[model samples]
Target: MRFLFIVQGEGRGHMTQAIAFYHLLRSQGHEVCGIIVGKSKRREIPDFFSREIKAPIHLVDSPNFVADKKQKKILLGKTIRKNALMAPTFWKSLKTIHQVVESRNPDVILNFYDLLGGLYNFLFRPNSRFWVIGHQYLIHHPEFIFAKGKPWDKFLFQLNTHLTALGAVQVLALSFLPKNDLINSKFRVVPPLLRKEVRKLEVKTEDFFLAYMVNPGYGEEVLAFAKSNPLVKIKAYWDKKSAKPIEYPLPNLSFHRVNDQTFLQDMAACKGLACTAGFESVCEAMYLSKPVLMIPVAGQYEQACNALDGEASGAGIASNSFDFSLLEKAEKKDTKVSFQFHQWVDSWPNILSELIVSAEQESGVKNPDGEFDSSPVFG
Candidate 1:
């Protein structure tokens, strides 16, 4: 079967999920027709994705709903304002995307949380089946549990979910937590998608701590904590303006950009982690049996809930702020959760294939189950 994958190129998480799905499909003897990546001026496509993903990549200008740094929150007003301004560009991109999809005539169209997917469904009305797949899609399910917070904040999250769900044939919500009220609506619960590389990497418990802050605001706080502790070797990944392999005055601290090979290598060697409570990173850390100190970005509800869930599951400690004392205490004790992630990893490919087949059949697309039903190609 030929599949067209639409991805939101906001962070490493979406791209990683795409990479995982791409490999899984190919391994199952299905062909990925092409990839449509939403491009943001603020972010550059990482080298890792370009080099690793074999499919042809096309860029389209899409709406980006980003956090407001000044307010230190996700300003729905600002998000709407910015997205409104980009409407023309978005329309143009949509036209191009529709042409690409029509040319490919794919068996199914899979979306990796691209807002453009909603727009694509709105504009193109393709005869091909469309399925939305991502962790963010969990928000749309009625079974998802929302952390108690300001009413407006909660409303905005719901609004975000609703917007993403517009015209989606099926929504796949990925989570490590149990399904709840928010997740049970309009979506099927799926396990977190992890890359084959991550699954294959050997886990080793070393003395060093792994730290990553994709947000620059938290870089100084983490660096200070790392610097204060001379006894602990800190291999931190920072998103600051700096050269690679930047050695700090502190003997045991070092920082690098998003170097996949180095990051995975360090993760394998780290005893534990001190990082922001991002879903993918935390999942990877837990898979490697590394306890984490989850310092969520202030005013980011998702990260806050992630931190709370991580703590609840005994995977890590949650800190209201980045504190060296907290890190010191967490380091002395072990809080790794013993979970069978291998089961999820092994089942993902089959699950994804089944979903694509189901969606295609519903849309009356020919070759609905694609190559999977015809023969056994992958071991």
Candidate 2:
């Protein structure tokens, strides 16, 4: 079968999921015809993704969040206004997606929660079967628990999630813990799409703590922590394009650019991880058995939900600020939970293979050539 991946190019999480899925499809003797990633001017596609995925990537202008001056909180109002003004550009992007889909004509189109991908399917209604993938889809699960308060935030987040699933026939909801599939509603609970490299890592517990901030704005908080605790070493990574290869704001504090290999190595070696509540990294830390401190980006309800879910799954403690002290003072984390989570993650291969076939059969879409397409998604 031929597959085409449409990924949202916002943060590292979705792109990493796409990379894992790319390798999985190839290993199953299926072809990935092409990849269309929705991008914005705020960020660039990481070098590791292009180098690792080994596929032709198409970048299209799409809606994205607007951050405040500190680059911390998500400015929902401003974000809507900005994307609303870019309606014409987004329309062009939808057309671009259609053209790519028509040209490649894959057997299955998988979207990693890219709004443009869903919008494209809604407007064009292509013949290829479409499926959506994300942890966000788990929000509707009866067993899922949401963060306290923020009713409005949850509603908006769910609205965006729905928009991204407009024409999807299957919703693959990635979860930290196994749950019964919502078959009646086209939702399947699946394991996290962890990359092969993660499994190959030699885990270790080093002296320093590691941190990853989706927005560099939180670096200030990390710096403040480092300043107060001068003896404790800290290694932080951020998406600051203008930053140096390695920045040392203080003798014991250092910041590095977001590099896939380096970040994984750090996660394996660090005593604990303090990062914004993005799903992938927390899962990585759990698989590596490293305690985590998740501080959700303000106004990002999805992340707030992630922090809550992660804590319940025993990833680590949740905090509203970058307080390393909490992690240090907190009681020992549960190793049993980590063991269970690792087992859950290790089941991805068998589970995903079976689910993909089920999804194709459920959609009733045959391969374009009456057989699996042998041609590669990229040359």
Candidate 3:
């Protein structure tokens, strides 16, 4: 079946997931016709995307999280106002997506939890099928456990997840651990898609604690931690565009801009991994058998759940602040959990194939080879 991807270009996780899934589908005899990525003036599509993804990538304006002056916490009030101001541009971008889908008439519009899928279904009311793929969607599973935090924040986050799934035929929730006894079988739980570059790496233990800060505001905490612990080497990667790599005078801590290949290699060999509790990074850390120390971004409830879940999966500890000291204990715990997660990762391909066939059948479109009316019969 022909598929088109709608990705939220807010972070590396979704973008990498799209690239990995694109290749996976192609390998299974499905064609990815086009990719529409939601982006903003504040951020451009990462360079690796154009070179790595086989399909053409189109960037369209979308709402972005606005950070406060420190650029660390997501200011929810400010974020809403900023996106409200850009409503016109965002609307036009959705219009462009509508035309693309209408012209291509793809059998499935695979959404990487982009907000546009809902808007497009509401505006154009097209016959296309949408499958929302993201770890965030796992929040709605009846048997899924959420992190303990502010009740309001958890509610808002779940509401946002449902909004992203508006008109979606299925929510292919990506997970770090396996929970097959989900109360809502309407949604399928699948393993996180680690970038192929990451999965192929030869794992080892090195001297450093590799770190990534999704919001550069967290950089201050990293610097403070590195200063306090002078002996532990820390190599961190950030998306601080227009900034040169810095080798701190502290002698053991250095910050470099994100380079996917280098990051994966460093993660594979690093003594431990530290980053915001984004689902994909935690999954990669687990896949590499590296211990994790997660600090969820302030005001992002989805990440709070990830931190709780990651720790529950035996990955590591979570901190409200940058406590790199936890790496020592967390690394050993992750070792115990790695085998179970590996089983989940190995199960995705088969489960995903079944999902694709079901989605295509409901789409009322012929399978790619036209031999089956709706079932995806692989070559």
Using lDDT as the measure, which candidate wins? Answer: 2
Local accuracy of candidate 1 as per-residue lDDT tens digits, 1-379:
8889999876577888888888888988889989999987655777888887888899999877466553234556777788988888888999999999989998778888787776677567776666677666665555455667557766766665555555665677777654553432335777777777776787777777788875656666766776677787777886544445566647787777777778887887787777777778877776766677888766666677677766765667888666645555554223322345546546677777777666545445435556322210100
- Cα displacement (Å) at residue 154, model 1: 2.0
**In model 1, which regions exceed 4 Å deviation?**
65-76, 140-143, 177-186, 240-249, 324-339, 360-379
* Candidate 2 lDDT tens digits, 200-238: 999887888999999999999999999999989899999
Sort by lDDT, top down from the best: 2, 3, 1
RMSD of each: 5.7, 4.6, 4.4
Question: What stretches of model 3 exceed 4 Å from their correct place?
Answer: 181-185, 245-249, 331-336, 363-379
Better of 1 and 3 by TM-score: 3
How well is each residue in 1-379 modelled by candidate 3, as lDDT tens digits?
A: 8899999988788988998898788778999989999885555577788888888677788767888788788888788788889889888998899889988898788888887776676567666666678988777566567867588777777776776777666678787777674554456778888767876899888889999988878888888888889998999888776557565646888888877888899998898888998888888888888888889899887788888888777778888887877777653544446777777787767876888777655555655776434221110
Winner by TM-score: 2
Q: Give the Å shift of residue 195 in candidate 2.
A: 1.0
lDDT to native, each model: 0.71, 0.86, 0.79
